[model samples]
Target: MRLDKFLKVSRIIKRRTLAKEVADQGRILINGDQAKASSNVKIGDTLTIRFGQKLVTARVNDLKETTKKEDASELYEIIKEERIEDSHLL
Candidate 1:
């Protein structure tokens, strides 16, 4: 599955277009390297998304064409989520 699609299907970004835009802007990464929206997503892959001063990291657990809202949780497992405070940088 494509990274953008995976993000939407997994309910990460909420929309495919937003996911794509985020990826194109280099706000998304895979395995610690920058990744494009069209990048292939497979099980066991690690994804990190930058949201403002925060970062969300997750591991791909499974891939599916379609899934119910209840089943969406099976798509990926959140490994870590941290909010970076700008004050810490000062």
Candidate 2:
């Protein structure tokens, strides 16, 4: 599935458009490489997302075209969350 769609479907981001915007700005990485909104996301792939001063890392667990809100968390497993100083964002 698409990165943006996966983010939305998994509830990692509430909106697909916002996810795309974030991905486009180079704030997201897949397997340690910068990824775009249209990037393909497969099972077991690792995603590192930047949200302001925080960075969240998750491992893709499954893929679905659509999922119930309650089941969204099944799509990915959060592996780590860390806060970074502003300068590290560079």
Candidate 3:
């Protein structure tokens, strides 16, 4: 599955266009490497996403073209989520 589609299907980003825009801005990484919106996402791949001050890392657990809301959370397992502290604020 494409990264953008996977994000939306998994309900991680809420929208495919938003995922694409985030990926294009270099705010997403796959397996520790920067990824594009069209990047291929496979089962077991680790994804790290930056959302403003938060960083979320998840491992892909499943893939589907479409999933119900109840099933979306099963697509990935969150490995870590942390708030990025701005050093400038210190």
lDDT winner: 2
After superposition, candidate 1 runs with Cα above 4 Å error: 86-90
**Local error of candidate 2 at residue 89 (angstroms):** 4.0
Model 1 over residues 30-85: C-alpha lDDT tens digits?
99888999999989999988888988899999999989989998999999998878
Write one digit per residue (lDDT tens) for candidate 2, span 28-63. 999999999999999999999999989999999999
Better of 2 and 3 by lDDT: 2
| TM-score of model 2 vs. true structure | 0.96
Task: Flag clash pairs in model 2.
Answer: none
Candidate 2 segments whose C-alpha is farther than 4 A from its true place? none
Q: What TM-score does each of the candidates earn?
A: 0.91, 0.96, 0.94
Worst 10 residues of 1 by lDDT: 81-90
For candidate 1, list the clashing residue pairs, or say none. Answer: none
lDDT of every model, 2 decimals: 0.90, 0.96, 0.94
**Number of the candidate with higher lDDT, 1 or 2:** 2
Put the candidates in lDDT order, highest first.
2, 3, 1
Clash count for each candidate, listed in order shown:
0, 0, 0
Ranking by TM-score: 2, 3, 1
Q: Tens digits of per-residue lDDT for model 3 on 1-53?
A: 99999999999999999999999989999999999999999999999998888
